[model samples]
Target: MTDRIATFPDWQTKPTVSPVQGDLVYPGWLAGSWSMSSTLVEMVAPLAPEVTTPGFEGNRQFLNQPVVCQVRFLPANVVERNKAILPLLSLPTQSLVNAQIVSDRAFNGLNLAKAYLGDRVFRVWIDPRDSNRLITKFRDNRKLFSTATGRTVEQPDVDHFITTELFQQFFQSPEKPYKNQVETTTAYTHQPDNTVTADQFTAVYLQPPHPKAFLAGDRPVALYHYQLKFVQQGVR
Candidate 1:
C-alpha cells in the first residue's frame, strides 16, 4: 500500500507576478470591516452505510443556527513586516495588499458552545502563475494550520463575483481530536440595499482510518452547507 499523503494543487510553483502587472487582481471588495452571519444549512455523510444512521444524525444540531462573526480586512502593512514573508517573496512590497482578520463570539461559529477561539489572521495574494487564482496563507495561530487556494469567476457586466476556496487544515498537534479539509464556495451579488449578500457552501472531507471517521477506509466523511451574509460596517 502506498503511504503517500494526498497531493493538492501546487501553489509554490505557480508563477508570481506583481498584482498590478497581471490580470490577477487582489479582491478589493473584501477590504473593510463587516458583520457576518453564517448558518449551517445542510450536512451529509456521503460514505455512510445507512442514510438515516445515527452517526450522521448529529449534524442536525448545526442546522439553521446562525453564528455571527466580525471580519476585517486591512492593508498588508497592518500585519507585522516579519509576518509578510510569503507574499513578499513574489509580490512587490510596495504594492497594494490585503490581510484578513476574523473573530467571533462563537469561535467563528466553529464551536457551538461559544468557546473562545483566538483571532485568525490571513494574508491574501494573487497567484503569480494563474490570474484566475488567488492564494491565502493563514498565519500561525494557537488553534490550527491552514492554507487556501481560490479561483474567481467575475461577471463585471452584472456586477456579480464568486470565489471558491479549497482549504486544507491540519491539527497543530497530532493529539488533536480531529483534522479535515474543507471547500467553501461563496457567491457575491451587489444588492440594491447597498450591501453585498454572500451565499456559501462548505464541504468537509476526512480520510478513512482517521480518528474521527465513521467508516474504516479513505473517503469523504461529511458535507456541510452554510449560508453567510456580509454587511460592510466600515473601512479597516
Candidate 2:
C-alpha cells in the first residue's frame, strides 16, 4: 500500500487489496467532526485520444477551486469483533465503549456529495448491514450504486493512516446504464496543531459495458488528485 501512494500519478493497474467485509477503522485521533476543504490540484487522461473519459474536460473548471464540506468519523460497535481495533478512551460526554472508530458514511457522504453536486443530490446512503455498499441518489432520478470490492489499509504511525478502496460502480442514466471502476486512496496526517491534512488520489476505469472497455482493460482512463485540509469545528 505504501508503494501505491509513493508512485502517485504513475498508476496503471489497480492495487491488489483484500475483499472488503466490514467498515474501515480510523485512528482514534480522527474520531470527531471536521470541516473539510478539498481542492483539485491535478487531473490526467492517460488514454485521451483513444478513450477519453466522460468528465475529463468538464472537470477542468474545478481545477484550482476548493469544495468545502462537513464530515465526521466516530466510534461505533462494529458487527464483527475480529475486525475491531483498540480505540482511544471516549470523551466524558460521548460513550464509545466497546466501539471501533468508523466514518459516519451517510452523514459525511451526503454532505460531501452536496458540496460538489449541490442540491441536486437527493440522498447518499450505505447498506445498513454492509459497510461496503453505497448509493448516491440525485434529484433527477439518477442514482449511483457503488460497492467496495477490495481495499487495503496501513498505518505507519499513530498520527498517520492510509487507506485505498476499489469500488465497482453502476450509474443509472437516461440513455444507458454506465458501469465503471473507481479507486480512492487517501493518506491522512494528524498534525500537532489539532488539524488534519491529506493527499487523496482517485482513478476511474472503464468496465465491460463501455464500448472501449477492451482498450482500457484494467488500466485507469482518468486520474485525479486532490489536497484535503480538515479543521475540527470550534477549533482555530
Candidate 3:
C-alpha cells in the first residue's frame, strides 16, 4: 500500500484485494462528522482511441472542479438503524473518542452522488446488514446497483491509512443493463492541524459486455486522480 501511494498515477496494475464482507474500519482519528471537498486533479485514458470507457469524455468537464459534501465516520456502537432507511444517523460527540471507526456508507454515498450528479439523484440505500451492496435511484428513472466485490486495507502508522476497493456497477434501464468494473485506491493522512487530506485514484475498466473487454484485459480504460480535504463540522 505504501508503494502504491508513492507511484501515484503511474499505476500499471490493480491493487491486491480480499473479499469484502463487513464494514471497513478506520483509524481512530477519523471518527467524526466532516465537511469534505473532492477536486479532480488529473485524468488519463490509458486505452485511448482504441478502447474508451463510457463517461471518459464526459468526465473531462470535471477537471479542476470540486464537489463539496458532508460525510462522516462513526463508531459501530452509535450508528443509527431503522426501517426508514433515511441514513441520517445522528453522531454523538462524546462517543467518538478512541473508538472503532467505520464509514457511514449510506449517508456518505447519498451526499456524494448528489454532489456530483446534482438533483438528478433521488436516493441511495445500502443494505442495512451488508455494507457491500447499495442501490441508487435517479430522478430520470435510472437505477444503479453496486457491489463491493473486493478490497485491501493497510495502516502503516497511527495517522496514515491506505485502502483500495474493487467494485462492479450494474446500471438498470429499459434499453439494457450496462456492467463495468471500478477500482478506487486512496491514501489518507491526519494532519497536525486537526484536518484530513487524501490522495485518491480511480480507474474504470470494461467488462465482457463491452466489445473491447478482451483486448483491454486488466488495463484500465479510464483513470482519474483526485485531491480531498476534510474538516470536522461537528455533526451535520
Candidate 4:
C-alpha cells in the first residue's frame, strides 16, 4: 500500500486521516459528480464477454467521483487477541481495505495495507505527468509485520484507460495481448441548477505497432475513441 502522507508532498493541508475523504476532492478540476458508459471492441484473451447493464457496458463501467482510492482497516498477520488493534479487538481479526480515486480521467488508483496481507502492503501510484499513467510500489515495515527480512516485489504500472470518447476501457486482461493506447481531454459547462456539467472529456485508443498474423495484408485495426461527462456541484 502507498503511504497517504508521502503521496501528497505538496498537499495544501494535512489530510485528517480517516476511513473516507470523498468530499475533499470534489468541486475542483479533479473533483465532481461523474458517470460513464463503456463499450467493448475486441476480444483477445478469450475471456467471457462482460455483462452490460443499464447506462453502461462491461465491468469497466462508471467511475463514481471521490471514491476511496486506498485503505487499511485490519492486520492480516496479527490476531486480535484481546482486541489489541482497537475496536476490532472486541470482535475478531480486524482487516481493512482502503480504496481511493487517483484520477478523474479514468479509474487510476493505489491501495495500501495497515495491518494485513504480508509484512508489506501493496500500492498502485499513477504518474502525475500522463493522464493514462500508473506506477506500482510496495510498503514494508514493522506496521504490516515485516521484520526487515523480506523484499516485496514492486507492482507493474498499468493503464486502465481505453480508447473511447467516454474515457472508459474494456474489461480485458491486465497483460494486454496487444499493446493499447489512450488519451483524454476535459472541459466544463454551468448547469441551470448552479451545478457545472463538466463535459468535453474524450479518449482515444490505438493498437501499438506490433507483428500479428491477423495483420498479414494491408489491413489494420482502426483507432477507438470515446467521450465522458461529469457534473461539478459548487460548494454552497
Candidate 5:
C-alpha cells in the first residue's frame, strides 16, 4: 500500500501552469492619435444588384468617417494568441482578463459628441523580436453576443510606413447568432505626398461558414480594390 500512497502524493503535488506575460511598448509613429474613414465600394456584377437588398447594392457606396486609431503597449498579464502558450497559462481553470474599453469622443475622435460608436477600444501588443513590428488590435464589446463573451479583437502588424489588418464585422441576428460576417486584410503604406495608400484586399465577400468557422463556401468572394488616401489635416 505504500507504493499506492506515494503515487497519490505525486498526483496531488502536480505543478500548476502560469500565465504568459509581455511588456510590448507602442512605437513612436503611433504615439499620437489617428482618425480613420472608409468608403465601401462593392462589386458590380457578382453582387447581384437586382437582389433588392438595401445593404447589398451592387457597386454600392458606404461611408464610415472619423474612426479613431491608437497605438499602445499591452499589459504583461495579457496573453498573446499563442496556442502553445495557452495551456501553460492554466486558462481552463482561471478566467481571462477583461478587455479594456475607451469610448470618450476626444480619445476616439468620434463625432459621438452627438452619439457614439457602440463601445470603442483597442489594445496593442509587441512581437518579441523587434518592437518596431507592433500589433494593433481593435474591439467593440457591444458587438458581442453577451457581456460574457465580450468583444473579439485581432492582432495585425502595423508600422510607420505600412500595415496589415484582419478583422470581421459582428452583429446580432434573429436567424443566426451573428450576421454579415466579414473577414478582410488590407495593406497600407505611407505615401511621399503625406497620405497613406491602401492596397485594399481585392477579394471581399466570402460565403458562410467562414474560414475561422472551419466551414466551406460556394466560392471565394471577390473584392474591388481601390487607392483611398489618408491625409492628416493639422500636420505641419
Candidate 6:
C-alpha cells in the first residue's frame, strides 16, 4: 500500500483582523452638492462579438450625449466602540458618517426624474490608520454586490484619488445575461478651480463557452471608458 500524506495551506497560519475597529474619516472638500456629467467615450465587446451584450445599446446612446446627475453629501452621526466601557461600550465613540445621495437625469435632459438609478444612500469610510485609503459601502437597493477601495494623493493645487471596485451582479439564473465579475477603476482630480474631473474604465468578464476557445478562467466580455465632470454648486 502507498503512504498518504496531508498538507495544510499557508493562509491557515495567518491572523485575521476585524474590519469594525478601523477608523473612517470624511474629506472636507468632498462635502457639498454638485452637478455632475458623465460621458461614455469608448466601448469594446471582446467576448460577445456576434451579439450585443446588455447595457451596450444604452452606452452607445449616451456616447455622443452626456448624462447629468445631481449629487449631495449630508452629515451623519458616526459611532465608534470602546472596549474599556463594558456596559456602554457600544455607545457613540466617534461621529464621521456622511449620507450621499445621487439623483439621475431623464427625458433627454428636459426633465429630472423623481426617482434615481442610485436613489439609495451610500456611505464611505476612510481608514483611520491611513487617511489616503478608504472603503465604500453601497445601498440595499443597489443591483450588484460591490466592494470599493480607494487611495488619495495630496498635491499643492489638486487632490487626486483612484478608486477600484469589484462587482458581482445579483442574477437568479446562470443564463440571465451571464456576468461573472466586473471591475471599475476611476481616477478623480479635485482641481484648484473647485471642480472635479474623473476618467473611468470598466471591464466586464464573463464565464467561458460564451467564447469557447478562450482560456480556462473568465473571459473579457466588454470594456467601457467614461469621462466625468463635476462642478461645485453649493454646500448642502
In order, candidate lDDTs are 0.45, 0.82, 0.83, 0.25, 0.31, 0.44
Identify the leading candidate in terms of lDDT.
3
Candidate 5 residue 27 C-alpha distance from true site, Å: 7.0
| Candidate 1 local lDDT, 97-173, one digit each (tens) | 33432121112233322322223534344344543333333355324444453333444445466544555555554
- Measured on C-alpha atoms, candidate 3 has an lDDT of 0.83
Q: After superposition, how far is residue 71 of candidate 3 from its true place, in Å?
A: 0.6
Cα lDDT tens digits, model 6, 111-152, are: 212112343435434345543233333465223323222222
Candidate 2 structure, TM-score to reference: 0.89
Query: Each prediction's TM-score against the native?
Result: 0.54, 0.89, 0.91, 0.28, 0.37, 0.53
lDDT score, candidate 3, position 66: 87
Which structure is stronger by lDDT: 2 or 4? 2
TM-score comparison, 2 vs 5, better candidate:
2
The candidate scoring highest on TM-score is 3
Between prediction 1 and prediction 5, which has the larger lDDT?
1
For all candidates, what are the clash counts? 5, 0, 0, 28, 4, 1
- Residue 164 deviation, candidate 6, in Å? 0.8
- lDDT tens digits, residues 50-159, model 5? 22212434344332323333311122233344312222223321222233212221222223211223445343333356322333333632222111111222224343
CA displacement after TM-score superposition, residue 229 of candidate 2 (Å): 0.8
| Model 1 segments more than 4 A misplaced | 1-27, 50-59, 77-142, 149-158, 173-178, 208-219
Off by over 4 Å in 4: 1-123, 127-132, 136-177, 200-204, 207-209, 212-236
